[model samples]
Target: MSGWLAIAGLGPGDEALITPEVTEALAKATDVVGYIPYVARVAERPGLTLHASDNRVEIDRSRHALEMAEAGRRVVVVSSGDPGVFAMAAAIFEAVEVGPAAWRALDIRVLPGITAMLAAAARAGAPLGHDFCAINLSDNLKPWDLIERRLRLAAEADFAMAFYNPRSKSRPEGFAKALDTLRQACGDARPVIFARAVTTPEEEIRVVPLTEARPEMADMRTMVIVGSSRTRIITRDGGPIVYTPRSVPA
Candidate 1:
């Protein structure tokens, strides 16, 4: 049997958020590969082999998946949220690009899913309804200077921002630096949302003014959204609804 490889997104924490295309691909896969947690999300079956590895071994994992596919095994490489968004899809392409030329001819497809940014935005009443940009705040592959520049530029452009990999046990100071940079650049009371483990049983959403926002409010699991100056919050008896107007004034 001719084998193929698919890079699929499992969506944020909720299984229901996973796209039908990804589910179908997973069900048909003879081998599944991903980070330990993401691979754990897939159920075991008689015919499927699961390959789980450390989070930092993405390229290694991608090469393994490609090798499996080359050996005539249908493979699905899983990722949390969208595979194209800071996930396995890019890593797979990178591996393909640098590996054997025959690897380029292998069948490969990317299946998108709901990213945490969108899921968090949906639960927060559309903070990203207007122009926005998503940034990965971790300084792992990139330097902190670049991240700071993007943050400042995004603030200056008045674009709403969604931040991923905001904080971790090792890099606890990054988020704090980010908050200070935003506070200095934006210089306004726009709303900032802290959405933790969104769409799961541990979900927690907190809305606070930018001035009052703290670094500790966010972690690796948190999706942080900072509104543009044009963003607004409508308060009611139920709760405040945060959204950016569809139109911008001249």
Candidate 2:
């Protein structure tokens, strides 16, 4: 590879969320490669070349970025939220010269960003302070049966749960399926935190019981957090927050 691989994270959605370092990487890069939606987030940077692709075309995109770098071009692989969290960083590494010749010739740097789970947790007043696990209910990449098994284990262990790709417009029933699994293991009253379009326009956060997390309440843009048995839902002066106790020195 010709240049450094900056796995820059575009924080949340606001333009102000972009850090000086991230901006510099974008400012200096000759080629910027990323998923289509993430690449669109980059405002017109003068003379920057962009290679955007479909969402599922991750490996191809990574390979393309590497090819550009091998051609003596500085390339920055962009990812929304943290590049490592279900994003480009892993794909880049996977493609980075795995062979002795490949590993010896490439340079890569992983830059992290504000992940949706953390952003959503912040809006909900810390529902993930203690032991927690994130699960994607989508069966597109992973099988639904195994996802169901993780849901059972997480709920049974009373772990705080953050769901990425919780639901989509077409197969919106995934969240419902997850909730059903959780409710079956943890009972119906498990606290559920819903955040829509976090940090962007039309951001919304609310807490409901697990049994009450309706399909109408979520979509592709929504990230859902389901709390454990220790989670508490507070309604103070009509503002809602879901709090999970943190264990200090005992």
Candidate 3:
């Protein structure tokens, strides 16, 4: 509303997921920009311009959003999940890598959203309550070798991992490779979770051993949680849940 480009988060699919700050910013925004599917989730917002695009054009989208803000538009760039964790925040910052001082001074505020990892972890109990880390399986921007190295380190360290951007039509085998590496360090039967769509309609939470995961379930919409050696899985109220056990007194 103040002619500053405020990049806000709309959280997950549910409207109740939106925070008060995000709602206020959206109400005052003259325009919003995000991936088409994510932008479509905001059904009640009216009297505002919306710019939606494919996920592949991330840099272009940020540049365009900022350009509109520079033209005195109250712009709100949105991300489906959280803006900071593997979302639009990085892209917008990347767009300003070689910007003018004035361009850098443009007001930009990022609001946090409920990411699929946190939502999935909550549904799956306290699997990530320990010293866990996250990794993206899609190697579009980063090479597979780098992913492989990280997976190797995570496996060696016995860290519980949340796998994001697991698979898509073009990149199918990244999960398999990561799983294979994990199996060598842990065991073939190590507990792993395949959580799909999260809070959305197509939610699927499957408790499968590391070796039992099929490539069919891995996709961009899915978030996979690989447990550490101390993690355990059980059924609770007809839902699969994972948790790391409390440490024993020495």
Task: Give the count of colliding residue pairs in each prediction.
Answer: 0, 0, 0
- The alpha-carbon lDDT assigned to residue 98 of candidate 2 equals 60
Worst 10 residues of 1 by lDDT: 233-242
Per-residue lDDT tens digits of candidate 1, residues 154-191? 99999999999999999999999999999999999999
**Ranking, TM-score, top scorer first:** 1, 3, 2
Model 1 quality (TM-score): 0.99
Q: For candidate 2, lDDT tens digit of each residue in 135-176?
A: 877898888999999989888888999988888887878877
Best TM-score goes to which candidate? 1
Best by lDDT: 1
lDDT for each candidate structure: 0.95, 0.82, 0.82
Q: Write the per-residue lDDT of candidate 3 for residues 57-154, one digit (tens) a residue.
A: 99999989988888789988888778888889999988887665556878888888888888888878888878789998888889999999999899
TM-scores for the candidates: 0.99, 0.93, 0.93
Model 2 vs truth, CA RMSD: 2.1
Clashing residue pairs in candidate 2 are none
Runs off by more than 4 Å, candidate 1: none
Model 3 regions lying over 4 Å from their true place: 44-46, 235-237, 246-250
